[model samples]
Target: MDLTSNRQSWAVVGGGILGMTLALRLREQGKEVTLIEAARDIGGLASAWKIGNSVWDRYYHVTLMSDLHVRNILNDLELEDDMRWVETKTGFYTKGRLLSMSNSIEFLRFPPLNLVEKVRLGATIFYASKLKDWKKLESIGVCEWLTKLSGRSVFEKIWKPLLRAKLGENYQHASAAFIWSIIARMYAARRSGLKKEMFGYLPGGYRRFLQAFEKRLVDAGVTIQKGTCVQHVKRTGSVVKMDTADGFEREFDHIVFTTPAPAVSKACPGLQPREHGLLNGIRYQGIICPSLLLKKPLAGYYVTNITDDVPFTAVIDMTALIKPEEVNGNYLVYLPKYVDATDEAAFSRSDDDLKAEFWPALKRIHPHLTDDDLITFQVARARNVLALSTLNYSESLPPVHTSIPGVHVVNSAMICNGTLNVNETIQLAENAAVDFLKLDSRVAADVAGSRCAQAV
Candidate 1:
């Protein structure tokens, strides 16, 4: 499949992991690639910010042992030795107490559920993990399925609150496939010999990986245009043209939009009205996460699930998995709240407002945590962090190939059976690149045949 003689120019309109990976792959296949990023920096949702002279991820992220896609990327970058794996602990904040539920013994001893209810819950998890066809679960609501399998008592006390924390008010409308994917991922992490839940992180975090990847892209002759916002995309004859915010226009043989659905709709107005409506109708959930640098550790648990109603959804002690020495010997904790991305009020709230609202809730869990223990606090907002996995969500996803022949759409919203993570994003990018190249090869063959027929 050497495309050297039939090289096609491509424009990847997004700088996230998906866009970056796709552009790199296309370049490797002898295609002229130009990656356009609206943001000044790369990494998108996985972007990082400076913290007291050290850099860390803007949001909490970790690599599960089962994330083979991520591992492959690391290996390609020659960073396998940089990975550090650690067994992490999980905690449940309910009944006005923090309970450890990392292992089977602890789960059975949990106070919220009786023995029978706990048994049913365990069986539900095991059953869901073993399921191979997630499409079957798409028609069933998550709440209804969980209740039927784990009973109402366990559903309300455990599953409901956790679902609300992640999906907000849309949890009830979510499909059973949402929970099935989650259980499958967690189950795989514990299947090893030790059966411990282990997570891996690079010593310097994802920032290190992105830096290496960007360097490779440049060395491989991929054009990276940063801080360039694409306004609209149109197909003119056999080429795709992009209009940027700076009044500059560029043309390419093919265009791949790796942005969210809303951005995709905005950039490609030439799409049919029906196609536009479907893309616009897709909804997303946002996050307002505040990272706190503390002089002392607040909780030893890697993640504390809040079953109780609180200002924030979960308390994640990133240092529980990452050594404090990595970040200048300071503990890092993240308090995240998932909200509707369309809510103007939630997106407009100030960092001080979020701190004031979440401070008391933080104190409840760490009674000893005081203002003196906090070194600094920063807030990060991702307006379209996760796509809402509503029931039959797969049916609503726009096709990868749009009405415009050369234009394609691939984003987190297309992830029907799995959660949005780095690994899934990479997998989607790889698959989309393969599909695009195959289609391009067919088009080239057709053009060649037409020219020969006319000559004859």
Candidate 2:
């Protein structure tokens, strides 16, 4: 396929990581690329917001060392110094008090699971980590798989709540293969030091990541057009017919969609099969994450899980986690709630109304956090921010390539296996680029995904 036009242009829709990374990779190969985004900014859902002088994410974001793709990017961007590895805390709340939930030894001590249940659970994880092709496991439900393999107690105590939070009512039907991939993440991130389980974040927010990629894009000669919405598209033979929201019609030799799956299907309906229900079969709950700047740190731990709470499954006081001092004693909290598909009103709620409702619900978790303790608040809503990976979800996700050759799709909805964190985002972006470049043979290797395993 000849990607060269008279102007030698290639249009990349979506300015997020997948879009930016692919654009830069293509331009580095000496292709003229134009990047378009509807938002005023470039980071997509991955962008950061500022509260006074402190920068925080719309939702709490962190990466594991097992993220081979992210490791490679950080080194290439030379952001090693700008990064920090913190061994954070993970806990479960039952009837209120937080339990120390970290590592294998502590996992066994977890009151929620008995010694026998814990032993079986541990063995299951070890077995999963060594797995090569979990494709066959997709046939069974996750709940069924765990109950049969581990037992009823372990599945009820551990797997059920997590699946409920992650997949809503469809947990019972979730694929065993998908559940295994999720379990392997824990096995990969363990360590024995102060934090055998550690995470990476730039001293600042993810804006640093955006900046690094933007710099690389500029250096590679990619044209980045911000606040530009793509109004329409028409594919004519090898070249795609295009029309912008700004009322301009143009053409490109190739187009790669890094936008959300919903938007892509909406924009180019003809290219996708009506039966490919990977994303469409799944339903995503919108997030109403409100962050508050506080006068003090709410908790000592950087990360905490609120499995039992009102209006929210978890409340991440990012200020406390990243160190409140970094934000000048002002704490930032995230109040994220899952919403329905038809509930447009939830997404359109005002910030003030959100704060009024969010604060009291927050007080349920921390009673001492009075109204006076609240500093400032910001409400962020990313509609379809998380794809509902319900039971039997693995079969829904499609391969990188589609019937349309020059077109590619990548996003959070496409996290078919493993944790869909930033590290996975980077790896997915790199892998997509290889597909776009038709370089699959170059990176294929037999690496098991154990402890950040990257098997080709």
Worst 10 residues of 2 by lDDT: 440-449
Clashing pairs in 1: none
Residue 365, model 1: Cα distance from true site in angstroms: 0.6
After the best TM-score superposition of candidate 2, give how far the Cα of residue 10 lies from its true spot, in angstroms. 1.9
In model 1, where do residues sit more than 4 Å from their true spots?
1-3, 192-194
RMSD of each: 1.3, 7.6
Top-scoring candidate (lDDT): 1
lDDT tens per residue, model 1, 1-456: 464754788999999999999999898888999999999998898888987656899999999888999899899999977899999999999978999988888887999889999999999998998999999999999999999999999999999999999988989778999999898888988855545699999989989989988998899889999999999999998889999998879999888999999899988889999889989888889999999888999768999999999988899999999999978999999999999989899989998888888876898888988888887778999887788888788998898999998899989899888988999999999988888878877887899899999999
Instruction: Please report how far candidate 2 places residue 449 from its true position, in Å.
Output: 41
What lDDT does candidate 1 reach at residue 105? 80
